[model samples]
Target chain A: EAGVAQSPRYKIIEKRQSVAFWCNPISGHATLYWYQQILGQGPKLLIQFQNNGVVDDSQLPKDRFSAERLKGVDSTLKIQPAKLEDSAVYLCASSLNFHGYTFGSGTRLTVV
Target chain B: ELKVEQNPLFLSMQEGKNYTIYCNYSTTSDRLYWYRQDPGKSLESLFVLLSNGAVKQEGRLMASLDTKARLSTLHITAAVHDLSATYFCAVDDSGAGSYQLTFGKGTKLSVIP
Candidate 1:
């Protein structure tokens, strides 16, 4: 009955620094997703995982962004050498077998 | 990548009125999802329409899908101020090798009293 959980509701980092956001999906959920929502824009898919195995990550910037959902339970999204454009709300969502997603209160990243 | 578009990006309406928000997708898909988000908050699942002519309603909000038209509609009946929020419609990327939701630029609705 619990919702998806994300940590560090807000974060601030300097340009070129590194940062990470954590997420814990709901129990028995098989799909996990990470999305980046820039101000006034739609949430863009960064990565998606189906039970620890990556189902899609084509939108992720491999040179800077990386994500992993280990053991099919929790996920973490990392951005290395963060840029000003990387300042956005990182949202984590979970779904049961490709159904509707339940999102977490995203981590707002502010890169200075 | 699938492209989703929602018309009337911003709407300001008076309470007790009626309105509809439209969502259009670029591809053919059978399932469409609608979500509502409040200011500084997470998305809340509103309706998951799985087929053509599928309609679901809760309280004053109603959603319908037309697979052939690649469109969905969110109709607000007797609108209330509590319905003020951003509404987004999404569809799964049916392209090869990817499975993620493609979201539309949301429709921010404000119901004035």
Candidate 2:
């Protein structure tokens, strides 16, 4: 089975600039998640979507970060006015259920 | 809020030695997941443990869960250099309405030859 796919494997942006990352989940996957992982730290949930509708986004930095999954398929995460602290790897994962999460390779963002 | 804690934070062992990493969580959950991540790579699922006393082994790595104690252990037997990577334990928080996972800080393993 094809795994979740993410692109732009790497990106560099200046502070206060805007950037977007794309994610294409596996076929038939119903749940998608976005996570932020900093250097030497665990992945932190940024948002979650269940078939094009948001399920949870309590931890998202709404002022600068926003995510959406349209048509219940591919999803996109955008960061506006990026900050230096936003430098980290953004991972996208998809799942059919709670137990089978398949993750993408992630996009490494370096904000200077 | 569900909190997951992994002990030792970092572990360095010599090849052919054995060691165990621990994970403790603060809430009740129906499943636990173990994932391995190599440097600059995505997370790879290792095991999914459900229910009390569930144990699963693959190759030289074994994982056990104790739901009654809210704990899980990943034991490495005769560790090899290939097994040197960061390991994370995530607990499923069903009450969170979406089966969201609460992940531990991760245990970084380094196996020396």
Candidate 3:
């Protein structure tokens, strides 16, 4: 089975600019998650999707960050007006009915 | 709210030594996972422990979960340089239903030769 796939392994954007990251989960998985990891800290959950429908986004900064998992297969996380603090690794992970999660390579974003 | 805490945020051990990393959670959860991550890399799952007293081992690393105490441990036996990486423990904070993981601040291990 293929692992979760992410695109644009790296990205650099100026503050207040917009950026998006893409992720393709493992085939047949029903749950997808987006996490943001800052330097020297643990990964924090940004959003969660259960087969296209959002299960949780409590931690997401709706004003700047938004995520969607369309068709219940692939997901995209976008950050508009990126802040310097937003410079971190954005990770995507998927699970089969909420078990055995596999993570993607992640997109390293640098907000200048 | 769910919170996970890992102790000794940094560990430096000599090769061929032994050490343990501890994870404590502040909620009721049965599913616990241990993941390893190298610099500039993604997380690699090492162990998934469900239920009380579940222990799993692979190579030089062993992981144990004690649900009664809301704690989990990753022990390194005869540590090797290859085992030097960040280790994280996550809990399915949704009580085994949603599987939304709440991760702990990772334990960074440096195995010196």
Candidate 4:
């Protein structure tokens, strides 16, 4: 079975520029999540989608970050006017239920 | 807001030593998950503890949960270099469904030869 897929593996963007990361979850997975993993810290959930409907997004920065899971299979996370603090690894994970979350390789975003 | 805390943020031990990492959460949860992550890599699921007194072991690692205390532990028996990695504990609230996970800061382990 294929695991969660994400691209590009790495991204470099200047401050004030916009960047986007894409994720394709495992087949038949019903839940998808986006997380930001800063250096030396655990991954923090930015948003969650359950079949194209948002389950939680309380931690996302509404003014700069946005995410959507169209058709409940693929998802996209976008950051506008990126800041230096936004540089981190963006991880996408999927699960059939509450167990066995499979994470993608993640996109390392560097905002200069 | 739910909070998860892991003890001994950094640990270094000689090979063959034994150690245990503790994870404590602030609220009741449906399940607790353990994940291992290497440097510059994504998370890999290790164990999922579903109920009180749940214990699961794989190789040299054992994970146990005490839901009544809202705590979990990952015990490493006869540690090896391959066990060196950041360990994270995450909690899923019962009513929050499957998407939200509250994660601890993580415990970084290093094994010496």
Query: Best DockQ goes to which candidate?
Result: 3
- Compared with the true structure, all predictions reach lDDT values of 0.91, 0.94, 0.93, 0.92
Q: What is the lDDT of candidate 4?
A: 0.92
lDDT of 3 by residue, A1-112 (tens): 8999999899999999999999999999999999999988889999989999998898999999999888999999999989999999999999896668899999999999
TM-score of 4: 0.97
Which stretches in model 4 have alpha-carbon errors above 4 Å?
A: B97-99
Candidates in descending lDDT order: 2, 3, 4, 1
Q: Which candidate has the highest lDDT of all? A: 2
Chain A (alone) TM-scores for all candidate structures? 0.98, 0.99, 0.98, 0.98
lDDT of 2 by residue, A1-112 (tens): 9999999999999999999999999999999999999989999999999999999999999999999999999999999989999999999999897777889999999999
- Provide the lowest-lDDT 10-residue window in model 2 chain A: A94-103
The digit string of per-residue lDDT tens for model 4 on A1-68 reads 99999999999999999999999999999899999999998889899888999988989999999999
Of candidates 3 and 1, the better by TM-score? 3
Q: Please, what are the lDDT tens digits per residue for candidate 1 over residues A42-110?
A: 899988898999887878999999888889999999999899999999999998967578899999999
TM-score of 3: 0.98
| TM-score of candidate 1 versus the correct structure, residues matched by position | 0.96
Q: Which tens-of-lDDT digit does each residue in B1-113 have in candidate 4?
A: 78999998999999999999999999887589999999988898899888899999999999999989999999999999999999999998656544478789999999998
lDDT of 2 by residue, B1-113 (tens): 99999988999999999999999999888699999999999999999998899999999999999988999999999999999999999988888578777789999999999
Q: Which 10-residue window in model 3 chain B sums to the lowest lDDT?
A: B92-101
Error of 1 at A20 (Å): 0.4
Report chain B TM per candidate: 0.96, 0.98, 0.96, 0.95
Error of 4 at B96 (Å): 3.7
TM-score of each: 0.96, 0.99, 0.98, 0.97
